[model samples]
Target: MRLTRRGLLIGAGAGGGLLLAFRLVPRHYAGALVAGEGERIFDSFIRLARNGDVSIAVPFCEMGQGVTTLAAQIVAVEMGADWKRVGVEPAPVSPVYGDAVLAARWAPLWMPLAPSLADSPEGTLARLHAEREPFQITAEGTALAAFEAPLREAAAAVRAVLSMAAADQWGVGWETLEARDHAIFNGRQRLGFARLTQMAARFDPPDPPVLRPEPAREKPGSFPDGARPAYPRLDLPAKVDGSFVFAGDVRLPDMVFAAIAHGPQGASVLSSYDKAAAADVKGLVGVVHARRWLAAAGTTWHAADKALKAMDPRFKAAGRIADSVALETRIDTGLRKGAGQRVAAEGDPDALLAKPSLSARYDVEPALHAPLETATCTARLEEGQLEIWLATQAPDLARRAAARAAGVRLRDTVVYPLHAGGSFDARLDVRVASQAAAIAKTLNRPVQLMWSRWQESLAGYPRTPVSAQLSAAMSPDKQRLLGWRTRMALPASAIEWGTRLLDETSAQAAQDAAHGKADPLACEGALPLYAIPEKAVDHVPLDLPLPTARMRGGALGYTAFMVESFVDECAHFAGAEPLSFRVAMLSGQPRLVACLQGVARLAMWGGGADASGQGIACQRMDLAAPEGLRSGFIAVVATARQEEGAIRVDRLSAYADIGRIVNVELARQQIEGGLLFGLAQAIGGSTAYAAGLPQSARLSQLGLPLLAHCPKVDVAFADSGEQPFDPGELGMVATAPAIANALFSATGVRLRRLPLLSEGF
Candidate 1:
């Protein structure tokens, strides 16, 4: 029974009876944990040592998101382990650690046809596909939703076995014993884990172990203002002391450093280079050339970079070059002339919006990820086996790509995951792994590839540029919205990204397959938060020369700006206060209403009148979780003023309701970091393309906000007691609109484009 993608698709289209029957069969995990001497393994998540030390395996990548600490905290609380003895390590790639939640959320990418059949983690199709592919990629904030339950269950099973071992000694029922403080007790009898681990390994854990009444949760006021975290981040000490290991920090015996140069946007063929110039540099090993890139290796990275620069490699453009003017023209033409594909709708929006009362256009330029660390990977191919050290969000995909590049079997590839300085969803791309593997195979030695800042700008994909027109039909009084429509023009960014990620296709091939296709992921958050009777969201796909990928905030990063800014304009047109106008329409969402009112009170409740220099905006995100849809709500109030011919944001006040708080300090830090990241996007992080290259190649040229220029940020969370939601992207989605609206109040001018000053305000 050979299975292929084409056969599966054909079966799915032919009534899907075969696939349905296959899904009905129960599936089991077949992977086992590798244990060391004097250590006992519990499933695939926990390893207990004779020294009373516990090492928990985290499947998600830790790119400064506090995921390692959060995951360990759950296990610690459930198993009653001492926090001081708990540590975290990266989990091995196995079926047991597959992320079913992420697979279900991304069903459209893998199972494009009839995605509804596998749109849940529990669905057999979703679980089986995830396990088969071992899809444990760490994007979309699904870490907690996917792993929290299993981690708790694993810890509970360990506790049950240890309790049983202790009960055997005390001659009592295991249920009468409790496991806490690294010890199992029955009445006055106590046995430490160091003594019970060997005995516990001999007993079988009970089926369906009993879980605690409640999972780990921090109280609302657990950590007050200027207080230390209850459980400090386990990685903080090493990171602060310059001992944390990133991809670039990995070293191997007799390793050579390599630097690469990629062709321009429209170029693929490497035409020529000055080999003589590189030969003059001392310690230069050799030069390797690929179809689209050239690499030079040396004893030191500096020598390799210097030799590469001296060689002056050049490439020939194979097709049309990417230009900013041409990209903008395509967007404008598509918005006006291209036919739209309806992706979401509630009622007859076309009829209700025949005569729109108000319509406004918004535009956003392509933005960069600009993490502190560039793309870095180390690879060594020896004796038909490939070993790679990389910091990637998708480990299995990267290993597969690297194996193919080295011309080895997938089973022979070993990937060692490392920490990233910062990703912002940039590590999802695995091109560097393949490039490193190729270079190492060519050189027949260990090689570490590092992309220079200039090369990163020339090769990295930016967030898609978008142009949209929002139309609204209001009542006779012009105070209530009756109909709403959003017509957005952009490339099929989501499809392009998915093809490259899931299919391992080139950027050009992905773009070709995605051209003219309507992407629902690209139109996410276009739905209005307010209760409008009629609404429609339309997508106008455009074929562009430049490629695009996902960024930190995803689609809502831009859609929120358009919707919230337009809502502010409508409020002014109705001659009503901004906060009050929003509250009136938010009758159905009590959570959002509470956030808005709370933010108003936090920021002194000053109406956004003329010269008030105050602006308000709100956003709602519902992420797919195992139990159901988990939601996160946020509202931002910004104060801005013009000082010395510069826009100065004085303060930003935000209030959020993200259900139960797990780690209070970590949640607060995530919100603050998101606010700063959004501020950077609002000010800069964009570039203009000319002659198939970006005009801004250096970080200094991107006009990022300085620390001294950063605004005062205040964040507060609500005690909603709902399911916990990740607060990473909530603060970012609303920051741009709040600042733009603030600038509008400060000066009697509205900036309809991102970066506020792109049109030279």
Candidate 2:
């Protein structure tokens, strides 16, 4: 199926693998939860073995987001399985194991009534119909929202069978049997899962199984009324003890290590290599030429690296591949030159903006993922079937890329997902995985390819650079927002471009790249939630050669920086306090208003009499399906001061309402991480482009936020009593803008550019 914007969004929603194995016991005794062999195999998510082991296979790739735990929690809660006995594994690349994150992405953002878990049957069916095809991918924080219902239904179906088996065994009505905590109880007697598993396995599944509603949280947090799931992180212990297997640590018998010589230009074609200079290197196996890059195989990684460095390859059209000036010109032109595609518009914003208005332009430099682990993959082509092991967010994409590279059938390729060191969205690109497969296929031996720090930095896709302009006019009295307009110009994601460029014809790719979907992922947060009588939002997609891809929060992180910071500027122009101005504008969005108020309270906004300054910003992140399935809200109050010519963030407090949080600590951590990431972007996180190449390829040059640079963050979760939403990147949305606004409040400086300090503090 073609990956249109709709498809990309659907697949981009949160999507994982389990390391545990399922064992079997030879037994067959005869129920609704028990499934005959034929029918039991239908559900790819939950597998109940005769040994009473319940295993859940998640199609989402886990990169430290606790997806495995989430999947297990859903299944255990629904199936009544013991959390300790439950096993988690990565499901194979199959539509049967497709993710619901896509279904959520398929939902548009502008729909009047948001999609919810409580949608009527007709609404739910309409959503299902809009989803052209069910595919698997993990992104855009769709994991829990997408999989919760389906997984619960699957588990509940199994539980019903177990209940039926117990009723038959005890000669009692099924209604008398209660399945809880991995046991079936009938007043005075109980049957353990092991004994019941054998009987259930032989029973036929009910044609239409009765499913239960979501289970109440095992225990209450500070809010006793809040329902939350309690789960021990299944992937943590192994990681802490060093037993977790990341792709970097994987090994295979007689495996040959390969090092890549990346083209400085974005996916530059391989021209020539210095084979003679590397011929004398010890343990040097062979140098393989692959599309867009070169790989050197050796007995050891060091040997391969040494040989690769000695043989400096050159690309045909290498010099001045990506020029920062040229890119900026393109983005600027796109933003102002054309009739921009209107993402959202209401009333008469242009006419209102004709009056005296507050205007600001925010430019975000290219940012890199700079994940600690780097790009690593191990692949083998044998018996006309290709097998690959890697840490990737998109396993199915990797499988397809490998199949195409190896000239094999897609069904013949298998992708084994391992723990990722870190992947904001870099691993979603399959260039490295495809290259590794091609090299392995050529050598007829298992090949493990690991990009060196510099190569990975140069070859991996970075976040797209963008330029956004915000213009707004207040009422004649200067007490209310009258009109607002935001225009963001950004290049289409490299994934979309690559989808069209490689293998597929341009005509076919153009068809797949059609628009008319919800705002592109590259401009996620350009539209604001603040109530404005007249408003306009436009997202201009630039056609550029730069390799663009998702980085951390996709477009939301940067766009939020633009909108919120500009809003602060507008607040300043209106002669109102930042918090008060925002609160006043949020007339209809009570959830957003509450989030803003909550953060202000947490940060002690306007309470301290001291001269210390704080800046506040608020946003509502929409993960709801096209009609409004699920949603999230966030606001941040940042406290910072200039010290010795550097911006020092002293403290940060964030308030969030992402429905019902599953894990408070994990939720807090995600927020903290996102805030720090945003702060880093504001302070120094950027990729420098020069002479067609990214100059900042090393960690030191990338200027990642150090621990000492992090501010003391105070997080508060709003008591919305709603369904859980993805909290993965919510904390990042408001960070940059809050810091920028806070910096302005502290020094009366108007900064409108990212790597925020680059424009001068």
Candidate 3:
């Protein structure tokens, strides 16, 4: 039976209570790993071979984030395996690898009625949904928080059993044995894991497992300049040598290349195509027509693309066509006249905001994901079974979509997850899987479907466009912020994306369900982290004609830009320094305060005075973990100036407090990469729509920063004893506002919109 929210509610009512319904829910366990000869499987996360090699199963997609290496390092550290012998494999879909943390955090998307009941990883509903749907999604930087403890426990169990095996032969107690460097040691005697794997499989691990004193942690300052990581990325050598495989790199026997053309966003029905023109194209195999798209299969991708172009498929509009002017008008109307639903509130913001001391308005256009690799999927259908290969954040959901599209049972569908060139949350969309499945089923052979650049732009959902008005009520002196309120206008984007992800519904259906609803996810991070007495956030949902999806920074991307830029303006209005103003308000958050101070010193902050071109911004992100809330703090000091009629960022210095450090090198890489991504978003990454199609169809048209345009970036992490917080998004959320504030200092003109200077200066 399919699990729907309505079905769940009905079951709960019929069973008298949610507790009884949960008890009656069927539980699923991870299937056994396919082990090779002389290999022993330890739970769902670890496999030990007779050659002393330890293979860690990484459930997260490796979209150039080093997740595979990070996961393998965690297991290697806990199991005391040799780093050189450690390897990683893409984990199979299973309930044991489900991401309960992400499920809990996104509880509102699935269980909108009572999300609080499942607001934690350990919550009954969260666990049940995660396991049943097998929600092993890889977005939101929740990898470590969800899988760290489980990976450690699995490794530790393997270590314990191996030691027990060695102890049996050494005639010593297992407690006296130490496992390290791929061997079990008892004082001077040593036994390699290869010699004991068969015997260890016979012994049962200690109840609860004997975990190490500290779960995998990297020493601060371990990898300084010119120093190599203790556990280097295992995928690096292969990636560098061109042996690493991505979704687009997959090749199968008797595979035909297919190129697809999707209808424009609003006009999604195929009306006509020139079959004779396509038939004349060399190497053209056949054409497959779907409800919304047309595909041409050929021996080579180039030929298929040529055939698709020759066919000249046309689509008729079935709904209101999306255009830039209409989108802006809708947002403006919502912010100006529509009734807003209060999404977040504290104290009495209405009373204070009645007479605001300062106010600002901001706008953000739809930003594209623009990953290096476009959507590519290879599928084969044979004898009622369908197998697909793709790079997806949500593998199980993609498999289900493929199964349904191919008219096969979900159990008969097999998914082989591949590395992504880059996703930026784009892989969360599983439409390519269904498209490939349909094409392969029609061709009755293996087919590799690739979306062209234009098709990707036409079909891909960009980040939601938003308009917001922020107001601040200050003290009598206008130095201290007293109350804050933000009214944002946007579509219920999160719910729309969730419906497509969870329910596998059409975009229009999802938009229909989410129309005119208050979306807390859309307004996330609008509430300031500062010590304000009264604060509130309101969401005015616009019924937009276009669909939207999640990007790298999520809502925090725009919310931070608005909040930090507004704070900078307030600081200036009060004749205060930008850094000092933020520090004064951040009394409760010592970590963020430290980061602000540290970044200021790193950038040699000049108080963001006129023509100084130095500006400061900070942000805090709190994520729920097993051990309470995990918070990540970041501060960026940007030095930017107007050069040759364009914005040129000179340097960006950042300080981050991401709690405990797992892998210092990888952490630093993530921060640096996020900064570059933010720089891209600040400069371009966005596009305008005309006649239901994006004006910018190619990467070059998006105005992404070139290598020469990239500024010098310096990153530092605070030495905190807090739980590990993923550092993937901190720099991204903080960079844009910093740059915007710096530009204001440089040119003495405040740019309020994202992709700063979208409105001509």
> In order, what is each prediction's RMSD in angstroms?
5.8, 7.3, 5.6
Runs with alpha carbons beyond 4 Å of true place in candidate 2: 1-42, 100-134, 205-207, 216-229, 318-320, 333-339, 494-521, 607-611, 626-628
Q: How displaced is residue 569 in candidate 3, in Å?
A: 0.7
| Candidate 3: residue 748 lDDT (0-100) | 94
- Across 76-140, the per-residue lDDT of candidate 1 in tens digits comes to 99998999999999987776677888889888778878788888987888888888888879888
RMSD of 2: 7.3
- Prediction-by-prediction clash tally: 0, 28, 0
Query: What TM-score do all the candidates reach, one by one?
Result: 0.96, 0.87, 0.96
lDDT of each: 0.86, 0.71, 0.87
Pairs of residues at least 3 apart in sequence or in different chains that clash in candidate 1: none
RMSD of 3: 5.6
lDDT tens digits, residue span 481-535, model 2: 8888888877655335334323232322432453322245556667677778888
TM-score of 2: 0.87
The better-scoring model by TM-score among 2 and 3 is 3
